[model samples]
Target: MVKNLYMLPEGLPEPVEDGACDHLQGLALPSVTRPATSGGSVDLSELPGTAVVFFYPMTGKPEQPPMRGWNKIPGARGCTTQCCGFRDRYPEFQALGVSVYGVSAQPLADQKEAVERLRLPYPLLNDTDLKLAEALELPLFDYDGHRYIKRITLLVEGGVIRQVYYPVFPPHLNPTDVLAQLRS
Candidate 1:
């Protein structure tokens, strides 16, 4: 119920700015299919056009405690806020011929709860097996027996990654940043 403490935590170092995404640009979209929170499945290889896929670690249930050390792991927190940002900006992204999606290593059922609770406009791609993470070589961290993908956004055009937004801070502001990148 509390805001992600790490979004702008006063003293902690930001974990995402240290060249984590340097190798990600121009990476071909991974050919994988995963269940979506909305229904059916989303095939990365089959995305029609420009697609915005924001990858986050996980979302915590309101009634449960987050994974151990969730707040201490830089870039590990704020999936919900980040998703909401994309939700608010879905219209703009859609107008630009860009389809927005959220990806995480959570179960489809958990993702469905988030979609329903947040009223997300887009489907959340479920990657419980971390297959997509392995395919993309995305940053990963483990906690209490679970592995989570680090928060990063990919701008894929024609099935190739065009831009990588790494170290997304203040997670809710990410969609606006993505819009700027697309416009420029």
Candidate 2:
């Protein structure tokens, strides 16, 4: 069964600062369209206004445990909690005229499971080939023979990236922080 790692006594580790990705500011969103857990293609370029795209490493499955040495990787845990945080604040984000999406290098099947299990309102984009990570030069980590994306959030407006939140820690608290930023 898929255990709720978030509730486990040994949950995700605190993220280490990787510095802000100011260099990515003003960069145009990638034109590539990817399959989403919600059963549609997510075309970043097609999103006209504000979009909050949070890149997470991977979501664990109830039937499958995380890869070996999962806890040893910094910012590698808490994908579920992070997704749930966005889910809880989804309506608030919408009220602010913003759209939220979770992106990861995980397969479509894995993402779908997370969405279904967590009842996530937003779609989770699948970048199994690491295309988005490559285009944005997002950090990558390899564990248990699988490549994963690091945790980060991007604020995109009018198809252009406006701001980036790097080294997100305490994953469940990010939505509030992002909401505050958007409001400010």
Candidate 3:
């Protein structure tokens, strides 16, 4: 059977909260420049106003087979769904003057493909060098000899992180959750 990238499989394990991101709140974003699908590097620290950055492991392409044991890894699945969710709700964020971004350790080519395939309104930043991840001390996992950032979301304003969501489960709903927090 063909796998559906947009639907999370039933019985997918839920990721538990870890204190890895606890210290992130109220910290100034580091001056890490990452290549964006929009065609230029962005310094998270220099972004003005509110911004939402959701970090995922990687996005799987439809033409390729799923990563080995991908579904079994908690928070490893749903990159595409999460991206689509943000794409769908991008207008709301734009109206609120919030910039949205997706980050992953995936290469720029892969991220570009995902952005085009998903029709994402926001750019997906390439963290292949892990500059942003290391600077922020984001949690990471290694699988098949490759390092990937664990699912996490950050709400940043004026270059400082004001809120952090760790072990973000049911990834598709993460954007909604962020929106709620922003509206509150």
TM values, all candidates = 0.91, 0.91, 0.98
Q: After superposition, how far is residue 81 of candidate 1 from its true place, in Å?
A: 0.8
Q: 1-184, model 1: which lDDT tens digit per residue?
A: 4545224445544675777678879878778999888778988877778999999988777677545556788877678878888988899998999999899998888888899988999999999999988888888888888888988999998889998988888788999999999999
Error at 73, model 1, angstroms: 0.8
> How large is the C-alpha RMSD of every model relative to the true structure?
2.2, 2.1, 0.8
Q: Quote the lDDT for 3 in model 1.
A: 48
- In candidate 1, list every pair of residues with a backbone clash: none
Task: Quantify all predictions' global Cα lDDT against the true fold.
Answer: 0.84, 0.84, 0.93
lDDT of 1 at 184: 91
lDDT tens digits, residue span 1-184, model 2: 3566665336656777665465787899878888988787888878988999999998887678656777777787788888888998999998999999999998889788888888998899999998878888888888878888889898899999888788888778889889998998
In candidate 3, what are the lDDT values of residues 1-184, reduced to their tens digit?
A: 4678989889999999878899898999999899999998899999999999999999888878767788898889998999999999999999999999999999999999898888999999999989889988999999999999999999999999999988899999999999999999
Write down the TM-score for model 2.
0.91
Q: What is the lDDT of residue 7 in candidate 2?
A: 51
